[model samples]
Target chain A: MHLEEFAEGNSFIHKLDPRVKFLTVIPSVFAIAAMKTIAAPIAALIVCLILVILSRLDLKKLIIRLITVNVFIFFLWIFLPFSYPGEAFFQIGNLIATKEGLLHVLSITLKSNAIVLLTIVILGTSEVFSLSHALIHLKLPRKLVLLFFFFYRYITVMHDEYVKMKKAILIRCFKPKSNLHTYKTYAYLIGMLIIRSFERSQRIYNAMLCRGFKNNFPIISHFELKKIDIAFGIAMIIIFFSLIAVFENTFTQVPIWIYQKTLALVGQASRLS
Target chain B: MHISEGVLSPAVLIAGALLTAGGVAIGLKKMDYNKIPGVAVLSSTFFVASLIHIPVGPVSSHLILNGLVGILLGWMAFPSILVALFLQALLFQFGGLTTLGVNTLIMSAPAVIAFYLFSYLIKRGNNIITIVAGFLSGAVGVGLAGLFMGLSLLGTGEEFVNIVKLVIAAHIPVMLIEGLITAFCVVFLKRVKPEIVGA
Candidate 1:
């Protein structure tokens, strides 16, 4: 029910240009992903945490979101320590936890949290519609942007229809058990939803034709970059670029002479595992 | 399931982004202006449908009907899924920005594969064949997606080999459920609105 809850704020982040937010957040996320050590992601995570706190988002909602994101991480933790073969960090009755595995999972955890938080703080702080508009400004295909706009516009309508259908079925004592009946019911529900959408699109298309429909959907508004927006963009670019620089032997920048050395290291490491 | 951001190595991320861009380009090229509303609304419907949670015990799992999307839209499932995921990221934060390309590829590539593999049967075949094709499409959609997600995870290191297997194993139930649901859905569509199945 609380769509774009993070976007509805008077904070400085909310006021920043969506274009800048898009341009900066993407590279920063990739940078966080590429970090080889935990320290860098921890730093990035701390920065994002501060930004989110400053943005005045509802902590309850943010906590829920973070918990959902961590579910995947939680799964990683379960099998990784016992399954990854390496120097033993600890021992259970028959289970062995590897030092390398724990470190790797920890790094993944930090980087994942940092990247998700950064994305929420930056791109998520703007209305999704505005972000679509910004995608056009960022040189994404206009057709894709228009599609995104139209998709978001109709999603709520379809959801309302879905809720109504669910209510009707619930009133009919439709209990969703793990059975053929439940599956069939859901299939019917989806089938009905699709049929309605297809039918409604016909009317929508006809209405547009009546209103002088064209192939192109043109925007009435364009983005105007402000000084503050540019300044924030530059600051973020530097921060993220520096984060990317922290990896001394990351994939993209391995020196040619050290290539064989790194390859040898990889071979040795593989042997260890 | 959407692989969260920052989990994949850059190599996998870049590969996913490139493939997704190529798929989206083909989809856009095939799509004309008039079909925009139809594609948008259809994808929106799928987006809403994904929220339906069926009880699997004490826990419930939401639907991932990429097979249905692929059958409905064919190649256009690419852009449709891309937009849906972007909305999910923006609205629910189910996935994040960095992993957008990878997640989109994970879901939609299988969708495209399912379309090619099963759409023909669903269109031209009789009731039993249609149901069988629908089941295959649904199962293949999630099955291939689970495989692709595992491969993407493997890009991080061989350490994730166990996780990769687990990820694929975990999807078996969903695949079965999706197969059944999709089979019935296709049958229903064939009965109620035959042309809407793919026309």
Candidate 2:
């Protein structure tokens, strides 16, 4: 339910330094994106799934995460295969699904699933505050890190405010319809929310200043990278890149070979004719 | 709209990240230290805005009041949107970490543009004109965002024309609804707290 619910586990992933997780996950995501063939991303997805299992995450939550991600990917499938122009794999009436398009969809699905699973397995194991700290340790801008912290802290508060406002409006017999009244009411609701937040922020700022708050958000916790953390980081990098490289070499060569074979067939046919 | 990971090429990703970094640097420099809390509050509002759905015909789409944020915060929309988007990606996977740069730029750049183009009108115009300006700001914000989304997808080998058509067509209702919402909000704010408009 809570974002940090799974973060408190004693799994090896939970104990790894957040900085190492951040560093490794980012590059792995990039490597997954850079992969040109389906096999690499499939491998990446399997690896991420294994990581998720090893992290001891609940099956229900994992399934929920996958469902949310797949909803978006489902839309991609609906549009991408029909729109991408290439060798036709199938046709229905006027719509044509291209070989290239289907391949593109497959690649995107695999890569996205892998990246999403990796993020949940890696970043989900650390508290939000610790993640910000890790970002700070990684030399990210202080302002950016503070922004993340404050945004995370206040998002729920703002959402609660919106909910209360909506409840009050609904109690007034306001039903949402597609018309001017609905739009105007919704706008005022949002306007009030913003104004309230603005005033609350002023008060909060004064309170913070009174408490001797400076621009910098101080982190009381320190992170130390253990030998296993370093080893895991290195191993992740190697596994991610080598999967890409291996598949890239094999897949890239196949296309060229197919092109040459087609060329040879064309030459023989022309000579015979 | 947020672009998911693995949807863009490395070239576009790097270019987007560099551009967003530059914008964020400027935004941070321009932000007042005392105003950081206000920015944070606005960032949270932006974060929750996506959950506020508005009914438009048969289907409903969520509000993305980037124009309002832009008009109020100016260049600070960059950092505000970045924070909200980062959290969205982290919490719900609505977007992806790898595509954060492109997603942030796609949403915030139009917002900043709306700020520059409409801030004066909203601040100085008569009541009706101010409303119209706000409407245009919101509509243009969504329109340009769709345009930018289409542009970002250009390098991905999709047909440029189809991408443009699809993006714009899907967002037509969103543009209209956001325009009305923005207009009403501007009118209300003008009546109650005009100074927040930063006119």
Candidate 3:
């Protein structure tokens, strides 16, 4: 399905080791997730935007990705503004938007976007195989690592098989609708996929056995831990700290100022209604 | 449907992560080397199936299939779902790292529950009993997942009361559809490949 579009690029971020990206991006995401203040997430968002541009992601595609990632935040918008208990920010019809509620949603929106962008730039740009390999180095159990490797390897194979079966159903003039028949059709299709996969697994196991498969997979290649990878990793750690440390005072001020300015314009327009 | 990153509190995130870590540990420990290929391929199938969007009246929703996954893999559903979710994040960006622990627990813990509750029942029951067990397992898997998601979000603040209610309510259609499909799928499995489910 041509997934992992960013993995094909060779930007500086892409050139960094997958293990290094994992080490840095994961903790950075946690730091972003844990940040309480509004300004902190704004700062994190700006840093992530810059990193995404440096990683050479397409602007249009990035926007599309952000919109897709905003589904949960969208739900927050629906309920938070009117439901939170705080000083009223504004009013529309019968509902009053709480200042605290709007502010909280804003911070969450920024934090969510920033974390996703950072992940796309850092881990998303690297080959997934390398990331799986990095898991081995990160001291995950060997079986778990091998399981991930094989799981990733077979998803596309199973997807292709699924597509073919769907086509066969289509040839039979099968029309899907909101009915039990449609649900049953899909159920049988999924059941067939499972059965096929089981048979496929048996063949795969036999093939491995014929090749003298051992309990452990032999590592033939290793990722060279380059100096630049470490330097870049440290740089990201510093950026992660600034998400909270540098924004301590602007913590409560800047975001309110920023939102108040925009909402002020909206407030003016709304009063005329 | 997984929770987006940054919405969950650190306490909820940490507790979820620790619990999931234990589950994955036990899951990995129990897995035999020979079963790796079987578990991997089956996990992949579930991954692909989850990507399929089926129409439910006016709207469409993707299949979750954690119920089916649980029925098949038992405790192994822990590691299986963990890997599948990790891949989903990398491939489709449906989820990310920070929420991985909570999301995995939300999906797989229910799956394990479904496994233990229905695996033996489906294997031994009559046709009607097997169907009922399958339906119950599928619905319960999704129902429990929704409850866990609400619980984790509740950890953020009580202000999330409305959202929590909405999340659980939103899963109703999914639960019913999951139940029906899993029931039919189980019937098909028993008829076509009894050994696969019987074992």
lDDT, each prediction: 0.86, 0.86, 0.89
Native contacts retained by candidate 3: 0.87
Real contacts recovered, all predictions: 0.87, 0.66, 0.87
Clashes of 1: 0
Docking class of 3: medium
- What's the true lDDT of residue B128 in model 2? 88
**Candidate 2 structure quality by residue, lDDT tens digits, A1-273:** 155656778899989999999899999999998887888899999999889878998879878878977876777787788888899999889989899989988998899888888888888788898899889889988887887788788888998898899999999999998999999999998888888888989998999999999787665767887999999999999999889778888557769999999999999999999
Which residue ranges in model 3 land beyond 4 Å of their true spot? A216-220, A248-273
Off by over 4 Å in 1: A215-221, A246-253, A256-273
Task: Single out the weakest 10-residue window by summed lDDT for candidate 2 chain A.
Answer: A1-10
The DockQ score of candidate 3 comes to: 0.75
Give the per-residue lDDT digits (tens) of candidate 3, residues A4-89: 77787768888898889889988899999988879889989888888887888877877888889898789999998888899998
What is the lDDT for A35 in model 1?
A: 87
- Against the true structure, whose DockQ is highest? 1
Residue-level lDDT tens digits of model 3 in B101-195: 88999999999999999999999999999999999998999999999999998888888999999999999999999999999999999999988
Chain A TM-score, structure 2 = 0.87
- After TM-score superposition, the amount by which residue A69's alpha carbon in candidate 2 deviates from its true location, in angstroms, is 1.9
